[model samples]
Target: MSHPLVIAYHLVWTVYGSWLPNDPRGSGSRTVRFDPLADLGDIHLGRKRVQPPRREVREFYDHAADLLKHPVLDLDKAARAIVGAALGEVVAAERYTCYACAVMPDHVHLLVRKHRHTAEEMVTTLAAASRAGLVEAGCRDPAHPTWTAGVGWRGFLEHPEDVRRTIGYIERNPLSLRLPVQRWPFVVPYDDWPLHAGHSPNSPYVKRLRAAGRYP
Candidate 1:
């Protein structure tokens, strides 16, 4: 997709060693860069939610977890808040427009509107800020790498439907993982985008914000 066509981006990345190339859920990777993980099949899978592999197979992937350089990141509430606050600062400083954001246990998802910056640049900046927050709070080691190695998923959204759908998906991610509904202060509501007028002001997130007394 061209830069101009993109109204927003679905930026996703895993914490270090959390999602291997051969995860039970589908992955964007084609190769298992780690030698121990290579023995497991590297099925070239799309990112869509599919019938997850068998439970045993899912548990089997952990056998190779020892090979990873750093522990998988399972962010608690405090860690999530730290990252969220740091992300809010980046959004404000860079003049980024965030339509949705979810800080998951093992990864993060953000839907940011088109800005003077590129999607990759936003991802990099946001990740750096999160790392700094963790380090400053003494949650992560100063030298520890926070995110997974290699390419993170970047799906560009050109249409309002795409933006709406992604917003829903990001919001439901935590619930699907059996985690509480995450409410981040950094996420702004997606009220009919000026460039594309069909976006709904009454998104699930909007309702959530209203329920929590967090919206205006």
Candidate 2:
């Protein structure tokens, strides 16, 4: 069957060392770049599957940690806030519309409305801004990487229900990570779709056009 047109994207990415090539939760990597990592554990290239126990998975990454070149990133409360602020700037500067955003300890979830930029571009830009924020705030070392080695994952969202589901999912990511729900200044509530309001009502783009707040 054909897929519906994508109205938005649900993007997710991990912090450095947070997820490995061989993870119980799974990864998107096709090949293990680090030879040492090849035999350390089995690689689960797909997003997720029905295999491996948490105990074994932890042991794998724990041993794998010693073979890494940089420290693992586990963002603290302050660091998450800093990253959120950096992202807020990007929303204004890039003129992007964010339906949901949550900064977790090891990863981030974003529900971004379909825009002039592609989903890949959205992840890249947001990740860059986050890295800059962490470095400038001394939350991260400039020599180390903020995100994973790859481009991360992005799935298209087409329907209004799909968009709403993704919005809820991103917002709840922090809680799943055992962190509190994140409230980023950049995130706007997903109200209605473009066909109804001439644009998504709560989106940054329309918020800009409403009244005197043109272009924020």
Candidate 3:
């Protein structure tokens, strides 16, 4: 049998202007806008940097708040549902396996297997679909974007343990935040994943992946 070409990714993205580039609490150089006084260190395009310090990060947020076009994102229930459905549709249409996802008020977490697309491409497509859904649902204004410009954070899940840990994190994010358990229609179980039982044992996708030993 041909080895499965399963590649997994754990992705994180924030709402527009929610987590700024100059955020003191550690930020990426790509997210920072042009600023005269910004003390940018280890300048690398689209890479995360260790935050300067908690006090410094807080100060930056305090000062930068006035310059923000929008306040911190806190999506309502309707908006969350719209975005979740949109993400699910994108996954299905792209033939990607979505292991888990969480749509938080300010950001989102997704664990998906890459197929016929790069991680960046998947993030961009998902963001675009979500923005359109939000606008169509009247959850967001068409004139304003709902997501940050670039992909926020992405890490490859090269090992089965990594995939398992990420899936746990995505599933438990809401509970960790002291919020109600998140349940969305988009989350699908992988039959080959021994860590989690498959929801549909007879599903063709599950069977194919299982037969090919593509659990991770």
lDDT of each: 0.78, 0.78, 0.74
Instruction: Give the C-alpha lDDT of model 1.
Output: 0.78
Cα lDDT of model 2 by residue, 61-81, tens digit: 798789888888788888888
Candidate 2 weakest lDDT stretch, 10 residues:
207-216
Per-residue alpha-carbon lDDT of candidate 3 for residues 1-216, written as tens digits (9 for 90 to 100): 644334588888988866676554546654345464255322344434553666876676666656667554567778888899999899889988888899998899999876678888999999999989999987778888788778779888654566878888888998877878887776777443423454565555445556777543
- Count of backbone clashes, every candidate in sequence: 0, 0, 1
Instruction: Write the candidate numbers in order of decreasing lDDT.
Output: 2, 1, 3
Question: What is the per-residue lDDT of model 1 for residues 10-45, given as tens digits with 9 covering 90 to 100?
Answer: 999878877778775667888777677776665557
Clashing pairs in 2: none
Q: Would you give me the overall lDDT of model 3?
A: 0.74
Residue 119 accuracy (lDDT) in model 2: 87
Shift of residue 82 alpha carbon in model 1, Å = 0.9
